[model samples]
Target: MKKKRILSLCMGLFFSTLLYSQMVGIKTNVVMDALRIINVGAEIGLSKKMTLDLYANYNPWEYKELQMMKMLALQPELRYWFCDRFNGHFVGAHIHGGVYQAAGIDMPFGIWPDLKDHRFKGHFYGMGVSYGYQWILSKRWNLEGNIGFGYARVKYEQFECKTCGDKVGEGHKNYVGPTKAALSLIYVF
Candidate 1:
C-alpha cells in the first residue's frame, strides 16, 4: 500500500511536468548499463535555465549462487543551467531512495569491510548536490557527465552469506561519500 502510493505520486508528478515542459529528454546511464544495471532518466525543461530530472535504476541478477546484487533506486533532481537547459554546465540538488541486497563484493575504501564475506539487505535515503556538463552531440542527441557527494542513512540486516537465512546483525549506518555518478546518452524531443 505504501509503495503504491509513492509510485502513484511519482507518476503524477512526472506526467504533470511533461505537460508543461517545453523540452523533454530521455536518457540512459552508460555506467549503470555496463554493470548490467538498467537505468533510465527523463529531464523536463521547466524554464530557460531550469529543469527537473527523474532517474531510476534496477539490478536483479545474481552473479553466482553465493554472490548477488539486487536493487532498485530512484532519484530526482532540480538543476540550474549555467548556460541553458540541456546544454553546457549545470548544478543540481537531488534526493534519492533505494533498497538493496548485496553479497560477496569488496567495497572500496574499506567502507563496508564485511560485505566481501557477508550479505546485507538494506534501504537508504539521501540528498546531495551535484555538478554536471552536457554536450550537444547532434540535433537530437546529447552526452552528459555528472557527479555528486552527500550523506546517506542506511539500515540493514546482515546474513552470513547470500543463501544463509540466519540473521547475524541489524543496524543503522550513516555514510558520507560520493552519491551519484553518471555518463549518460540522451535524446531530446
Candidate 2:
C-alpha cells in the first residue's frame, strides 16, 4: 500500500510539473532588415524531454523599390530536447506554410539567389527537420540558433517592377534546399 501511494505521488508530481512549465514566448530574427519579422509562440511541455511549439511570422509591409522582403508564415514544430525543455540542444521536425511577395530578395543559407534581379509575387510552403541550440541568457530570456533543410513548392508570377505591379512572367517552382533558418532573440516566460 505504501509503494502504491509513492508511485501515485510521483506521477502526480510529474503531471503538475508539466502543467506549470507551459510557456509563451515572442521572438524576432533581426537579420532580415526590410520585413519587420516577429514570431510569437506558445510552448507546451509534453514530457521532460519533449515540447510542442506553434508560432507565426507576419510582415505587413508593402514592397517598394527598396523594401524587398514580405511574407506571412505559420510554423508548428515538435521538438525533442536532449537535456531538458527550453534548454540545451534540440532536434525538431517542423512544417511551415506561407505566402510571400518580393523582388530581388535573397534568402539566406543554401536557398540563395531566389528570384535574382527579378520580382515574384506568389505563395510557398514546406516542411523540414532542424537542429537548434538554445542558450539561457537570463531567467526569462533565451537566445537560439536554428538551421533546417527541406523543400518548398513555390508558385509565383514575375513582375516588371514591385511598385508598378506589372506582370512579366508566371510559373511555379519546386525548390529542394534549406527552408528554415533563423537566429532568434527570444523572450521566454
Pick the TM-score winner.
Answer: 1
Overall local distance difference test of candidate 1: 0.92
lDDT score of residue 3 within candidate 2: 38
Q: What is the C-alpha lDDT profile of model 1 across 167-187, one tens digit per residue? A: 999998999989999999999
Model 1 spans > 4 angstroms off: none
lDDT minimum window of 10 residues, candidate 1: 2-11
Question: How does candidate 2 fare on TM-score?
Answer: 0.73
- The lDDT leader among the candidates is 1
List pairs with backbone clashes in candidate 1.
none
lDDT of each: 0.92, 0.73
| Model 2 spans with C-alpha error above 4 angstroms | 1-21, 32-35, 62-67, 106-117
